[model samples]
Target: MAGITRRKRRSTTRPAAAPVTPVADLIRRDFTAPAPGLRMVGDITCLPTFEGWLYLATVIDLHTREIVGHAMAEHMRTDLVCDAIDLAAARGFINDDAVFHSDRGVQYTSGQFRAALAEQKIRASVGRVGSCYDNAVAEAFFATLKTEIGATIWRTRSQARQDVFTYLHYYNHTRLHSTIGHNTPAETRTNHYHQASAA
Candidate 1:
């Protein structure tokens, strides 16, 4: 009895999934909107830490190039993206019938996330399969984050989350964006509202 060994369980393989019919590509690579709340793009990226992986989901406003909302967690579930959208909506950053563009990731395509967007009155837009260019704005944001955050790894997820929080604030309020005439996202947004009010 002391030397007895348990048999290894056989692993089962799942059948390949069918091709997903993605949501319409409403963006068409335009990646721009006349106003802040009309259009947005979101994507998820992973951060490495000794504890494990920390996942971040971000919702960015197209007009000001501002990261309006973001959520960080240990998992990349639909809830993570939904939480990001909810934050944007809660902050009054998303407009009625606004469009949210994302790649055809399962989390973005899943019924739960679509329902969340519908609840928020946000239209869902997805890129074609395997086409990174279709969601270039979101991809560029993550790339810039990786480059500017300058953290290859962290000792813990808490540290990673704190660093990301700081970076997002700096990105919105301090860092200048060349696409927006070298203005910070916060400044661009403020200027837009100021101009509109004066008009």
Candidate 2:
């Protein structure tokens, strides 16, 4: 198959070397949420750019499949994940009891990220190593993003960032999802709120 080719980063990822707080897998792979803000999954992916690699972290709402928060940077340090979560909080999409699910990546397991979650009053849920099913929704979103964005290496980091920004806007506003009755994520969330108010 003449499929799109993405630039592959190194396969091996290091576990957090220092002792870090281990959060329970509260989600247990159940991605379906009763409401928009109650559950979220986050992950990081690398995009190849001519200058270097651009790392993107995202927080996605389970109910609407909406990317409520995102952050992009050259490094995949723990701050990248923290920035994404902070954006979700700033956008008012995260609730105190929200279960923020993620894989056991070093960034998610770092002491800094755990502290960030604590400060936000969001519950942290981490899946075991080598368990894609635990964070399937986030993985699915990255797959869709890579598919739509295609495989060609971007000319520059700025170019990659701009393209991602455009794509995310289209994804959140225009793309219809079968999961939420063929509604765009924004539409699904809006309709949910409207329905809740009516009730």
Top model by TM-score, which number? 2
lDDT of 2 at 98: 86
CA shift at 131, candidate 1, in angstroms?
0.6
Error of 1 at 90 (Å): 0.3
What tens-digit string does per-residue lDDT give for candidate 1 at 1-199? 0112223322111121342554799999998899889999998888777787788999999999999999999988889999999999999999999999988777888888889999999999987877879889988898888777877777788888888999999999999999899999999999999999999
Model 1: clashing residue pairs? none
What lDDT does the true structure give each of the candidates? 0.85, 0.87
At residue 87, candidate 2 shows an lDDT of 97
Could you report the Cα RMSD, in angstroms, for every candidate shown? 8.9, 2.6
For model 1, the local distance difference test gives: 0.85
List where candidate 2 sits over 4 angstroms from the true fold: 1-5, 9-13
lDDT of 2 by residue, 43-114 (tens): 998888778788999999999999999999999999999999999999999889788999888889888998
Q: What's the residue-level lDDT of 33 in candidate 1?
A: 94
- Residue 172, model 1: lDDT of 97
Which 10-residue window of candidate 2 scores lowest in summed lDDT?
1-10
Q: Compare the candidates by lDDT and give the number of the best one.
A: 2
